[model samples]
Target: MRGWWQDLTDLVLPAECAGCGTPRTVLCPRCRAALAGGVPRRVRPVPEPPGLPAVYAAAAYADEVRAAVLAHKERGLISLAAPLGAALAGAVRAGLRGTAAGPPGTAGAPGGHGGGPAGGGRAPVLLVPVPSARQAVRARGHDPTRRIALAAAAGLRRGGVAARVLAVLRQRRGVSDQSGLGSRQRRENLTGALTTAPHGAALLRAGPVVLVDDLMTTGTSLAEAARAVTSAVYAARVREEMEAYRTGRSRKEGNPVYRASEMRRAYGAGHVICAAVVAASPDSVVENQELTKNVHRCR
Candidate 1:
């Protein structure tokens, strides 16, 4: 398999830190810390966007984290998933650590932030990925956001967090490529354009959900995902409450997405937000003028 080849090559390859490229190691110790560094802070994508659940970022959109994410996303270094997931897991734990700064109510919403019981033992956390357009996936040859979410879930599971990825989220309608758009245009492009797939919304009622995205810039993308997620959460809550009353059963075993204890109780954020952007375009990387000092010796 390709993954096996990559693993083998990793051993023989003269490597650089995926984060900072210190050389010789797939990842360096210091950069590893940087990737997982920082408390998960609540990031607001826009001023007028609806109330979004708390989001935890492992590292600021700077330095090493940016490089690692770019390597994984653009270059397709599939092997980097492990380290990225590990970093994401750490961020999630930090966000769960009391008082990270989010909307004031959610810490008070159904589950409260204090590691307390929602109603049953503890509310489960579901990691959801913001869907990418089919065309982009086709062009890139892989679903970047979905892939990262899977990696994060695996990391969380290994940590005994019992996390899972529910890929039921999808786009409601199509929008133009955001590449040429400014912040305002990007906002317009994504506005009201996302909707949950058939059972996606219903599943969230049972536990907490944290929507995951690879990167967050002006927050337009995240805001859209959050809106779609919230719609689903409320719908699921209403349906589950009604179903419980009608069926007189604790949970609908038929619907794994919405088992009583597993309904989405929290929504958070995770992104590989980066530094050193290009082209100054929507999501391009900029070249380092100073780094050229060593390379071409441009004066």
Candidate 2:
């Protein structure tokens, strides 16, 4: 299989910069800087949707960033997961820190927060990777997002945070290609497409859930995923509320669904943070207005 050869060549192949073809380094410091500037800003796709948690993308999905993502996703550049996960780790840290400063959400509960240094009483955190469609995996012969999530979890643990990947998210439906679709179209395409890992509702409901994705264009995927997670959380919350009411207890406000609005507001206000190993400048948000004919577009 070409994939097998590619995988072997990737490891046996000598040093060459993924960014600028510089020898002796697959990813040079300058290029790495492009990724390590992991400031997780709230990114809003033009046609933002509802029920999506505040998502922090790790990088702009353009240029070298785009290439790097594609390299990992399509090419079997499995080695790239480390650096990519490193960027995600930074974004995750930012999200946890911001939430920690505020009131207690599921993230505030014990075992919810992840990957914080042991200097304080910071609890562990959870990393939930957005699931990939079966077709995509079959085509690529790998699960890129899941692989990256695992790497990110490892990186988080190394930093003294008890990081774990909740490999429970699953795609329940097939979506049309997202190349040419507008945000609205994208939204419709992905409705009810995901659910928590089998019986994972309980574990996810146990605390704050951060949904991780490799790229966020219109952010429809993230939004839809948040809805699924929220449904799981809300169902758990409602269950608890009913049980509490039956036992003379009370429930809390705000359901568990992650919303795109939350993430947009966070990015706008610098609250939730997202990072990608490689990304175009943040200015690329404008490209969402029309199908980017220059590169890959669903249309």
Candidate 3:
């Protein structure tokens, strides 16, 4: 248990490493290296849930990694967000590697954030955080995932990736605590539980989007998030077509052919619909090995 002074001190100046309790550092060198050492890898839960976007994780959810995540999330050690966000940024870059970003010298291309030589007219990548439950956010006094996403976006920008955080997903209903829930139960509990804000679809159109979270256990949350995003984008397309038809626009203006092409352009290739996380369950990493091999083979 922690006292008020401890909490205050933790918020201001952490005295011990969040991952290994090494003295006099928010995160000691050993644990920091552990968190960010490995190359980010593709991960998938066994019996992969439908609509789950491709996910990349910086490390397995074990040992020091798990402790660090818990310290930052449950204990509200805000300073840890920087290291965690750096790890997440690595995963995001790995996930986006080789992904289509439109032709060079066009919008959404690499370095598209500014007209400056570094920016090259490329649009910033959008980082959509999985929304936490309202009650949970109130209890924690901060949205951990969103904070991490913001940190990750900052890191990405500093690295010339041109990223921005977009907190556009929301929970549409209440859910029982996911603790102790199996994969199937978690999936059932989260189905249709999330939706995008009215303006979320338009915001997502700014560039390729990457769903981000602090940790992934069963991947139920990310699947739901992906579903909500795709649904909202599809709904927006429908509305555009309906409005065009109502206005008596010609086939060139509102035809299915044109809409399909527009959707492809907006979403790019399958790479546009992917996710990244700081860590994933060890089981997921192991279970996904064969799939990862196949993915690499194709690439």
User: Which is the leading candidate under TM-score?
Assistant: 3
Tens-place lDDT per residue, model 1, 56-148, is: 555555566677777777666666767777666655554455334322223223334433323334444566777888777776556766777
lDDT of 2 by residue, 1-299 (tens): 24677766676673576655677655667556556553555455555677655555455665556666777788667767778888777667655654543223223223443343443433345567778888888888899888888888788778876657777778887779888887788888999988877778767643345667777776777777767766665566557666776786553443213333443232111121222222333533432322232223211
At residue 52, give the lDDT of candidate 3.
86
Displacement of the residue 205 alpha carbon in candidate 2, Å: 3.2
Model 1, poorest ten-residue lDDT window? Answer: 272-281
How many residue pairs clash in model 1? 21
lDDT of 3 by residue, 1-299 (tens): 34567657876787899888998889988788777777777888887888888888887777788889998888888889999999999888877763445434322345333223335456567899999999988887779999999999888878767778889999999999999999999999999999988788888767667899998889999999988887777667668777877887746654753566566445541124578999887777443454343223222
Candidate models: Cα lDDT each:
0.57, 0.60, 0.77
What number of clashing residue pairs does each candidate have, in the order they appear?
Answer: 21, 32, 3
Clashes, model 3: 3
Which candidate has the highest lDDT of all?
A: 3
Ranking by lDDT: 3, 2, 1
Q: What's the C-alpha lDDT at position 34 in model 3? A: 70
| Candidate 3: residue pairs that collide | 111-119, 112-121, 112-122
lDDT of 2 at 81: 78
